[model samples]
Target: MSEWRIYQGVGKPHDGIDRLPAPPPWRDFGNGEGEMTPFDRDMPAQGRHRLPHAAAYQADESTVEAVNTALYLRRPLLVTGDPGVGKSTLADAVASELKLGAVLRWPVNSKTTLRDGLYRYDSLGRLEEAGVAQRGARQDEQPTPASLGRYISLGPLGTSLAPFALPRVLLIDEIDKSDIDLPNDLLDVFEEGGFEIPELARAADVSEPVMIRPADGGEEVTVRRGMVRCHAFPFVVLTSNGEREFPPAFLRRCVRLQLPAVSEDEMRLRAIVRAHLPGADEQAEEIIELFMQRAATGELATDQLLNAVYLMSRTVKEGAPGLDGVARLVLQHLNVTAPAE
Candidate 1:
């Protein structure tokens, strides 16, 4: 059995509503033509990075259910939670447990756009290279069309939508920070299972099928006629800090799940502390109690507690002084309001 229960549902469930009858087979019905390389060959050897303490991180039942639902239905999972609640880490856990290649990440910002997620074309660099080629050409030699493939590279979304033998796992971090239109803009791509690259499309006649680099960085793949479509839809995990609301249309297409506060459970808090600071004993309980008390009064993130535990553990191990004062400083709540006089 896998260390995590989430991986057990890889291809088993089929309720038709949230689960598909079977995994979608790889098939290309669009203008794009390409083959997905095996995970061991094309993917980076490092796999997804995991913290030493992440082994003990646990997910609630609802969160696990949401992940399985998204996997079976091939739908994007919209995870909303407070900061440091492990919204983004969920994608890493899924990729790690399922043995999915790598997590293609797109960190969203206030200015992020839909096109930014699809691909980026370095026209200027290509032009510079073309100039160099032209100047070096002999009197009888002619420069061929600048390699369009060299200039274009796929982004997170495009890479996910590429024709892969198995579905790629994608993490769109802090999507709530994106512009209002970004969510709606992603609807078409999510529904269509593909997107077109106009730059490559315009040059299709000259460049029938070109090998281009994908976002994940590895061997290049052939893109036929500038159209990139997916045989297997990517398992997309979009995270938000609950800073903004999304359109109903966007929400309709996604499976939504909210992460509950960890401070509510004493056992869970202890587990997190033990994972991060294995040496912590009675100190772990004291710190967790203090953390819960502070959390109950103001805005606090789980990482703050972890940081305190780590510092205290290090201090004790090194026989350092001022452990209490240091813990107090690091464990202080982040609330801006002034404490009672």
Candidate 2:
């Protein structure tokens, strides 16, 4: 409720984002009315998975603090955690709670580059189309056809950078999975809140401001003079499974949060179970205890706990219900394989 804390984590829609003071001169892109993506429109009807995941997310004290800090500072949250500790769900929770619309996610991989997150142009396709156009045109006339904007579409990361009044939630899942230097490459854009689309920039003189579909879907965004800037910095969540190290500069810019081990939080686990399988409370604790035991041995995911409980509820006939064979299979670790006979 404090004036400085824009995100309350209450999971209710509010205009608090509007009340947020202007970003420090450096982070503020401009005052222009930003475009609204489909997610920025009616969310309840967007048929997105964000709401349900948001409803189920149970934020602890540390999570709430880190989230608010990132929101208030307009910085990316670098969430480091064991796999499946709900690192990525944080984006959905904030988007759903704040009525920010759908989360724009760019799932990073070994081959992902900064440009991969940006717009993609069908250069060859355009070339081929131009060839066809030239062939069809009259001998004395010029070949006239569509513009390059028709071949360009923004990706999730590019769409998030679109000038928007309120921020969109962008989940850069598994940042550690990206090749080295990618995080460094992102620093400039993160600070500038925009990037020049060379394809559009080069054609700026030849074309009017282009109207093109954004990756987030819904509304067409206007790209003027080949540059995209934001009125507000989108809330960015970069998740890492502690898979690799990031450059110190990237670390400094991000509000780093290392999620507490899920096994250590008993009450939190129970709450998660209650949120998911309301009636499974009867055997939830037993399943959770075993899950924690397995988690202690090696890598484990929170979903495995949910999966086990769901199975137990259906199969726990009269008394046989303590981490049964079927449940053990579900609780298997991502890193630890089953012991040989």
Candidate 3:
């Protein structure tokens, strides 16, 4: 709802096909032909994103629907779940479905700050320039705009706000790992599409004033007012490991979804097969079933199942594995002896 003022381009606003540049030969901006191309454009056609057919995830249709809605609304998705339950995978799923782009992951930690997530303003470079300008300047001359702005670098959060037709998906992984106030700070930035580059704002420009774009990308567009407006609202997905609770104010604005630890049956070979694991062997099923039953007592995590499958696959690939091989698979891959009663 907040608005940021933007200055007009030095040239006239681009129009029609001429305004649109000739797309790179390889990329598909969605308007082209039958097959999907990888090329990203200034403006991409917005549409519904299809999710991957993972049975474990699909079992919870509400969760999927919540995520789909978040992507459509361009709001933050809060995922709360046990560790190793594939909370982070949701972001990947959304990115894959929309063919939007890889998730711009912002892993949260205790020390993570708003500025850390936003772009870094080159403090040292700015200091060095100030020194150079001071030494070169005549007594009457004052510091110039060029001396102040070059050292500025935008951070991940700020970069995510960069203007584009297709908004990039931002995965704020494990918000619970950081301090409680982190979410509030993030909310402020999300409400405003862009943040000001303090260094650049000090300079006076007739045509363009504020520089805005992702940190990694080597371009900046001028933004006006105190806020940045989004052309395409970013698909912001925030995951939590369930170590703590969030404030009500923050919770009120977000659509929260919880991912449960996958059931033991969900990890079995039959389950895996149903989930689209092709060429599953009978031997694999027996071993997986054994592990799943033992793990039901809240012992081994589901991640071990993936390891077991890989081992089973390798053994089958290299002829029938003996007892020693199976033991090795259980011990080395699963990282536990037979589950304790």
lDDT of each: 0.73, 0.80, 0.55
* Model 1, backbone clash pairs (residues 3+ apart or across chains), number: 0
If both were scored by TM-score, which would come out higher, candidate 1 or candidate 3? 1
Global local distance difference test of model 2? 0.80
**Tens-digit per-residue lDDT, 28-135, candidate 3:** 222321221122322112222223322133224556567655644456789897665667766655555445554566888999998888766667776676677678
Ranking of all candidate structures by their lDDT, best first = 2, 1, 3
Question: Residue 155 in candidate 3 has what lDDT?
Answer: 66
Ranking of models by TM-score: 2, 1, 3
Which tens-of-lDDT digit does each residue in 1-341 have in candidate 2?
Answer: 56666677676667776767767776777756545433453463365554565778888777888987887778999999988889988888888777787788899998999998988888898778768877888345432212777888888888888877678888999999899989999999998988988877776765557876788765877888788877678899999999789989999999999998787888889989998789889878888888887777677788888888888887767665556674557987678463421
Clashing pairs in 2: none
Off by over 4 Å in 1: 1-33, 41-48, 136-146, 317-324, 338-341
Give the per-residue lDDT of model 1 (tens digit) for 1-341: 43324444332222222222344442223333456644442232364554443345567778778987787677899999877777877776666556566778999998999989999899898778767777888345432223777888989898888777667889999999998989999998988888888877876767557777888885565677777888667889999989888999999899999998888888888877776677786667777887787788776788888877767666675555444675567766666772631
Q: Give me candidate 2's TM-score against the actual structure.
A: 0.91
lDDT winner:
2
- Candidate 2 Cα misplacement greater than 4 A, ranges: 1-3, 31-41, 138-146, 316-322, 337-341
